[model samples]
Target: MLVALAIRDVVLIERLDLVFGPGLSVLTGETGAGKSILLDSLGLALGVRAESGLVRAGQSQASVTAAFQPPPAHPTYALLLEHGLEAEEEIVLRRVVQADGRSRAFVNDQPVGVSLLRRLGALLVEVQGQHDQVGLADPASHAGLLDAFGGFEADRAAVALAHRDWRAAERALEAARAAIAEAQRDEDWLRHAVGELGTLAPEEGEEEALAERRQGLQQGEKRAEAVAGALSELTPRDRRGGGNPAAALRNAARALERMPPPNDSIQPALILLGTAQDALAEAETLLARLVQEAAPDPRALESTEERLFALRAAARKHAVAVTSLPELLERLKERLSALDAGSGQVVALEAAARAGRAAYVAAAGRLTERRAAAGASLDAALSAELVPLKLDRARVTVALTPRPEAAWGPDGQDRVEFLVSTNPGQTPGPLARIASGGELSRLMLALKVVLARGSPVPTLVFDEVDSGIGGATAAAVGERLAAVAARVQVLVVTHSPQVAARGAQHYQVAKSVTGERAETSVTALLPAARREEIARMLAGERVTDAARAAADELLAALT
Candidate 1:
């Protein structure tokens, strides 16, 4: 509820402060008394569009602040939290408009964008009037209001849950389809590559092992070749060649034996040659053993080279290191396996999605039925309120239109609008479009009286709801306003004495001229002052004795 309002340099209102309480409060004054200026000031504080002309003369700027004390669970607090603003026991919304028409907004003294302030203001208070019916005028709020009145929380929750499930299932199906499509595009390539890799069957660390073995074999081959060359030179293939030292020594000994016996010099030469021949044979044997021990298997080296080359070629073809080939092979195999299974997976997910959508449709269908029933009840309730408010020819309807399938949402796929026809045989139209100023205000009052229990805003301000009506009709408007105020705070600007008399709290708006400057002032009326003010409203500029008696009777009836 709005707790207080402070205005400074706003049109005729200069430095005015007024405190308010919860209940039906009426502001009454004569024509040209600046009553509308108070509502304008309040609208400025609520983040309405500001005009330079609203600033007082000779003032550079005008500022208005409105304080509200909503409950902890109020949606305004939630909105503040969403905007990274903090609110304690009180939420103060302040707006300042420059003489150039520029404006700034603040909430709880924290600077904020005017849009956010406007949204918060909407959640805090709803202003219904001849031309400023905030919540009622907007068709977007109709569905929510209907849902609130219908009390379809459980059904709405079911629909929301089903919607989430359906969307999840759809997403899962899409992912599976994409995966299968990509795999199918690569199916032939994958199969051929898998076959090629399976044939190669590369192992981790096989390259390094083959390389080490090749190096050892290469060193052995070199040593064996060097040994074979040395052995061939030491023992030629032909025995007749003089290069064979052992053969030459044996022939020399045979020649020496043929010489005359007892030739000691030749005998010494033979002995020495025999010793040389023995050493030569022993060296040949040693060389043969060394060749046998160092010789490498050429077939084994060739096989190793072939295997290593095959592995490296496969690595290059696959664009991966030899060590990673094993993991890559496994991954490709898994993808191929998934390709074989993806069709069934897609079918299952499609079924799940269909089931989910079916569930949502069922829940939403139930919610629609309930809302229709509630709409009928609402139409009846508002009908009861219209006649006494002097709208006997008016007909109100709760129109529910089916939304397109593509536009379905968790709120259950129906568009709710309040339509009104002010006269018989006239097609019902939107409340704002069909009703005139006075008719619209009274219609809004009737609707509000019915929707008070479901309204989220804590305060409702009506500007001249008693316009174009008097006597019992004005009294009826006041009674309805009081009934609504019982559920939420209400403030009505009125000139009807019947409406003014119904207020639990009254304020008189009067303009005073001081030193060529006219300023608006608001004063909270005590019991005596309130009686005089209502009497003045009844008598118009003069409070006659009869008007005073009528005011007393009006006040006496309240007790």
Candidate 2:
């Protein structure tokens, strides 16, 4: 609940501090007694737009501070926690407006932006006026209000969860469909590439091995020519059939052995001839082995060269290194496999999406049914309140219309609106259009009375909600305000003595001139002082004996 309001150099309120208590409190004074200024100051503290003109004539700045003590469950606590600010037992919101029209805001003495202050203010208090610019007047908030009144938070949450799940499933289905479409677009190319790569079957480092083998074969061909020429020289096919140097050397040694006598020279010559024959035979054998080993088959050399060139051509065609061809092959094969299985995968995704949608529809259907029932009950309750507020002819209706699929959301499929009919046999219309200003205030009051139990705001301020009505109608308004105050703190700025008399606390706003400066002050009236103020309201400029007697009667009736 709002505990206090302090104003400094704001308009006519030069300096004032007013402490507020729970229950209905009425602020009463003559016209232009700065009641509006008081509300303006409160609005400033609540983060309303600040103006330089609000500063007093001799002051450089204007400031307003509002103090509140809200319960733990109030939304302000959550807002405080969200901003990384401590939620103390008491919360203070202050706004300062400079002479240059600049302003600053603070919550619990921690500097904050005006936007945050306004947000927190909305959750802490709801200011309703005859114009109905805030709170229930907004059509966007109607659904949330209906849900709160209907106690359908859990049902609504369930529907929200289901909606999220349905959306996620839809996204998954879309992604899978896109993947399959892309794969299908390239299906033929993928299959052909896979087939080509499979046939080639290139391995890592196979290029190097093939190149080495080809080089060895080319070198062997050259070496074989050289070895054949050398062997021909040693053992040429000439006129003497397959004669070699070893045969010639052996003939020489035999001739030497036959002609040798006991001469030393002849003996040495025989020995030399024998040694040359042995050396020539060894050379001939070695040459034959070399020629045989150097010979390479032309078919094998052609095959190795072809394999090496094919590997290089495939690598260039695929825009990959020879070593990476195997990996690329595996990847293409995987895409092909996925394409083959895509139909089944798409079917599974579609089924999941369908299940998700079904679950959401079921949850929303149940919630809509319960909301309709609750709306009916709320309408009946609000209608019961209308008769006493002098709107016995007015009827309230909760309109629940199914939203189109395109407009459906987490809140469910129904759009809730509060409709009203002021006279019998007339079609009900929206609340803002169906009633006069006074009637609308009363209607809002009736709704508040019925819906107060679900309201999270700790304070409600009604500015002249009793405008242009008096007598029993004003009394009815007072009664309703009192009833609402029983549940939460209510501050009403009014001129109706009956409404003022109904207050658990009464305050008188008065203006005075001091040293060429005008100032507005708020005084919490004692019982006797309250009677005089109420009498003043009843009697106008002059307080009459009869008016005093009526005020006393009014006070006595409350007991």
Task: Indicate which candidate wins on TM-score.
Answer: 1
* Poorest 10 consecutive residues by lDDT, candidate 2: 131-140
Residue-level lDDT tens digits of model 2 in 452-481: 876688799998989988999899899999
lDDT of each: 0.89, 0.88
lDDT of 2 at 535: 91
Per-model TM against the reference: 0.75, 0.71
lDDT of 2 at 47: 87
Query: 1-559, model 1: which lDDT tens digit per residue?
Result: 9999999999998799999999999998878899889988888888788899999999999999999999769888778888888857899999999999999999989999999988888888898888777778788888778888888778888888988888899899999899888889999998888888888887888889999999999988988999898888777567567577667778888998899867877877889889988988898899999999887877999999999998888889889998888888888887788799998898999999999899989988998999999999998988889999999899999999999988888888798899999999999999889999889999999988887776789999999988889999999998999899899999999978888888889999988899999988899999999989888888877789999999999989975
> Which residue pairs collide, candidate 2?
none
